[model samples]
Every structure is written in C-alpha cells, then in structure tokens.
Target: YCEKFCVFVVSMDRSFLPETPVPSSLSRRIGGGHWDKPYNRGSLMLRAEISTVGDSQEVSSIHSGQSRLTTVGDRLMDSKCKCGAKEQLILCKSRLEHLVGDDRKRRRCAVNRGKLAAAGQAALRILSDDLLAAVTEAEAEMKACAARIIQEELVAGQLRESEIGIVERGCALGALRDKVASLRAIEKASQEKLRRHVDRREAERGSVLEQLHSRLAVCNELRATLTAIKSRLSLMRHRVRSRQDSLEVARSDMEVYRKVLDEVPAIMVDLANGERETLQRREELERRAMALSEEMKEIDTQIASVTNSRAQEVGGRKRCLEREGKELDQLAQRLDAMQEYVGDCQQRRMSGSSRL
Candidate 1:
C-alpha cells in the first residue's frame, strides 16, 4: 500500500496560501540536519508546509514552495511560525506519519525558541503538552486508515463472484438455444411425411374408385346378355316340344311295321315250297309230252309204208286211217293248251308272293 500526507498553511488573514518561499538547498539542509542547528523564518514556514507521498520502494511529491493537497483539514499543528501563519496537517499511514511528525516537531521547536526567549520555563511546558497531544491524534488517524483498506478489499471480492456467475449463465443459454433448433427441425420433417402420406392415400382412393366404376359397367353388360340368352332358351324349348310330338307318331308306325316283319319269314317259307312243287310237276309233264311226240313219229313212218304198198289195193282203209290221224292231232293240241294253263298258274303264284 502507498500513503499520502499533505500539510497546508493558513495566513493571519485566515485563508489557504503558500508559505514564504524557501531555497531548495536550505529546505533539504533543514530536513536532514539535527534539531540543534539554527533555522531561519523561510525554512521554518517551508518545513510546516512540506508533505510527502510514499510507496513500498520510493517516495515523491514533496514541493518546496507548493503542495499537491487539494483540500485542507481543520486540524492544526501545535506550533506558530515567525511568518504569522498556522500549520494544518492531514496525516496518512506508515512513513507519511513520520515525515509529517518530523516537520511538525521542527516547526514547534522554532516557535518555542522565540517564545522561550520571551517567557522562559512556562513556554517550554506548553510545547511539551502540545507534542503529546499531536502523538495521540496521529495514532487515531492510523487506525481509521487500516479500516478503510479492509472495506475496499471486500467490495473487490464480491465483484469477481458476480462476473463468474454471468459467464456460466451465458453458456447455459446457448445450449438451450441449440436444443430448441433441433426440435423444430424434427417437427418440420414429421409434418412433411404426413403430407406425403396423405397424397399417396388420395391417389390410391382415386384408383379404387375407377376400378369400381369399370366393374359396375361390366356387370351391367352381363345382365343384358343374360336377358337375351333367357329369351332364346324359351324359343328352343318350344321347337323341342314340336319335334317330340313328331317322334311319338313315328314310334307308333314303327311298332306296326315290326309286327308285319315278324310274319314275313313264315310266308316266304311257304312260297318257296310251292315254287319247288310247281317246278317238279312241270318237269314230269314235259317228259310225257316228249314220249308222245316220239311215238307219233314212228306211227307216221309206218302209215307211209302202208300207203305206198296198198295205195290202189286199200283206198277205203286209207280214208279211215286219216280220220284217226286227225283225231290224234286234236288230242296233242289239247295237251299243249293244258301245259300253257299250268305255266300261267305258276306265273300268277310267283307274282302274288312277290307282292307279299
């Protein structure tokens, strides 16, 4: 820590002012020299106005004729100077206290010397009392300075904690923002998928409706064709009934023919037997006729021989024999007529059987 001490002077006119100027060399000599050394008025007032600022390693801000102090305190040093100005001291801690104390002691000694030259032992007693009072005041000021430093340190620590909390809150806010963005993206994708599903369902519904319409048309056409087939079936049933009636009439005629066919075999057997008998009878008659013709020829030869030998001798006998020959011719003619009649009967029998 660094400390600052300032000392100011009040003139007899009761206003802050610079003290009577002193040479830099004389001020330095007075500050470093022993108290027993003789001093001048400018040096005494200059020492009373002197102040210092001190750090750990170096000290500065000591002016010979001016001060860096912007404010003057009501606290005065227990000393008076030949220039008729009073001294005001504002003390700090550590080395600043020492510097101010030494300057005060010197000012007091100079004041004491002048008063001692006039008032003797009584003036020395008053100076001693003022020095003790100044020391007590210095100690109280040091305690106040220590308390102020501690308060400043506490304020600085609170500020650092607040800054750290702010940084952590900022990081948490950033993470929350990123999580919200991802959720929004997922919601958008879900909505898009739902839209696509709706479109596909619409397409399928349209195709199903078209198929239903086509199937309905085909059903109507089949209904019309079924009506036409039913009408044709009714007409075919009528034609079949008429044809069935014709078939019944033909069945009756076939039964009668079947009975006649059963009798025809026996009738054919009888006709074959009759034709065999006729053929045998006709063959017998032809053999008999052939014999008769041969006999007639022989008789003709005999009659011819007789007529040639007895032609004049038997004329009447020839007349009788010619009459017998004419009668034989008549019998042969009658046999020819009977043979034709038998042939005609045979022809009539064959025609009758053929007709059957």
Candidate 2:
C-alpha cells in the first residue's frame, strides 16, 4: 500500500508546464526568463518535493486541461472498490488535487510546528534558568509543610482520647477508674503512712541539728586554716609581682633585641647598595680604561705616522742640499776660469799698445 502511495505520488505532474499559471507563493523564486531569482530554502524544498512526487509523463496529462477516469483510476483504488471505474478515476484525480493542495498546508504546518517547538524550548529555557529554582523551593517547602502537618496529625493521634468511659469498655476501664470507696481506703492508708514518715523526719531533723553543731566546730578550725592560707596567698602575690617585674625587664630586653633585628635588614641593604655602587664604579672605570687604551693606540699610530712623514721630508731636504752644494762648486770654478781669461786679454792689449 505504501509502495502504491509512493508510486502514485511519484507519478504526479511536476515539470511546471510553460502554460501552468504561476502561484503567488512560488512566483518570488520561480519566474519567467525576464524575472530570474535565486530559490529560497522553502522554494527549494518545494521544488524537491514536487520533483519527487511527480513524473514528466504525467505532467502532460495533468496539465492538458482534461483527465480520463480510465487512465489511473483502476491502478489507484483497492480491489474492494465498488465504485465505477470512471468514478474511481475522478475520485483519484480529486484525491491527487487534494494531496497536492495538502502540500501547501503541510509546508505551513511544518513551519508552524518548528516555530512552536522553538518557542516552547525558549520559554522552557527561560523558566529553567530564571524561575525553576524558586518554584522547586516553593514546592519543597509545601511538601515539607504537608509532611509536618501529617507528622503532627500522627503525633496528635497517638495521644489517648480523653472521653470518659461508662460501659463502652465494659469491665476493663471500669476497674481501672478511681472509685469512691477505694479512694477513701487509699486516703486512710496514705494518712497513716504520712504520719509515720513525719515522725521519722522529725527524728532525722534532730540528728541533723546535732550534725550542724559538729559542723560549726569544724568551721572554726577551717577559719584558722583560712587565716594561714591568706598569709600564704599574700606571699604568693608578692612573688607574682616580682615575677611580673622580671617579665617586664625581659620584655624590655626583647624590645632592644627586636630593634637590633629591625636594623639588621637596613644595614644589609646599605651594604648591598654600597657593593652595587662599587661594582658599577669599577665597571665604569674599566670601560674608561679601555677607551683610554684605544685612544692611546690612536695617538701612537698618529705619532708613528708623523715620524714617518718627517723622515721623508728630512730625506728630501738632504737630497736638495746635496744638489745645491754641487751647483755652488761648479759656479766657483767657472768664476776662476773667467778671471784668468780676462787677465790674459788685458796683457795682450797692453803689449800691442807698447809695440805701436
């Protein structure tokens, strides 16, 4: 039967024939070429459902604006169907339309059911989070009150009834009740016993007076003992005072020790600070010494460079002095030759004049 139902559902027209009028619910997502839109979740679900519940073959017949009762009627109805084949087919078509229509209602019902469940859960959560503790407490308090009331009722019920019995309990209660004759007998016996007890008490009282007199003598002996104890107590008090004074002196000494202990940390701190400062100064001195050594190296390099430059200048000056000294000797020999040539020229001129 379920297979038939599935086949029937799967055989319905689905392909949304070009001629099929658009419903308002589906128009937003499924549109003509001019109005395209993405399918929403609902539209997609509807499409999937339609595709599953419909066939391309049946779409033509369903959309053909006419349906024959003979087409699907014989296949859909049970063997017990008494209706005519044509009538059955019409009924089938009507049922199909009704089922199709129910799809819309089903969709709405699903949405409503989901909404109701979500709302119910939200309300339940709120109640659990905000009110459950208080409600449970109230219920517990009510239960305790009920239990207390029941317990009180049980305890109250345990008390025997105060109703006096005449013949209800017959002989048992009758015998147990105080009777006038028995009460009179009991009274007479009680008076006799009380008289005997009174005479004995009076005798005991006389003996108690004699004991009291003996106690008075003992009390006089205790009085003397108390005086001696008082003297001892005074000595003890003096010793306590002395001990207290010693304790005060010890406390003063402890205070001095405490002061010394308190100063120890400050002294240690000062020593530590001095050590740290000394270390810092030592590091600074080392750094300065290193810097001075580097400067001394630079000074030594500069001095070496200056000495080399001066040596080059001295060598150049020595070469220049040797060249100047050779030039001076050549000039002196030339002067002597020129002076001898002039003397020869003068002697030649004088001998010529004497010959003329």
lDDT against the true structure, per candidate, is 0.45, 0.50
- Summing lDDT over every window of 10 consecutive residues in candidate 2, give the lowest-scoring window: 28-37
Question: What RMSD does model 1 have?
Answer: 79.0
Candidate that would win on TM-score: 2
Best by lDDT: 2
Candidate 2 — which pairs collide?
none
Candidate 1: regions farther than 4 A off:
1-152, 216-356
lDDT of 1 at 94: 34
* Backbone clash total, candidate 1: 0
Q: How does model 1 fare in lDDT?
A: 0.45
TM-score of 2: 0.27
Per-residue C-alpha lDDT of model 1 across residues 1-356, encoded as one tens digit per residue: 11122332222111343344434433331111222223444354354334222221122333322343422311122234332223123233233446456657866864564343334334334444644454455455446445644654564465456446545644654565465456456545645654575466456546645654554454455456446646776766766576666646645644644554554556456545655654565566556546645755665576566446545434544464566457546655654554564455445433432331
TM-score of each: 0.26, 0.27
Q: Count of backbone clashes for each model? A: 0, 0
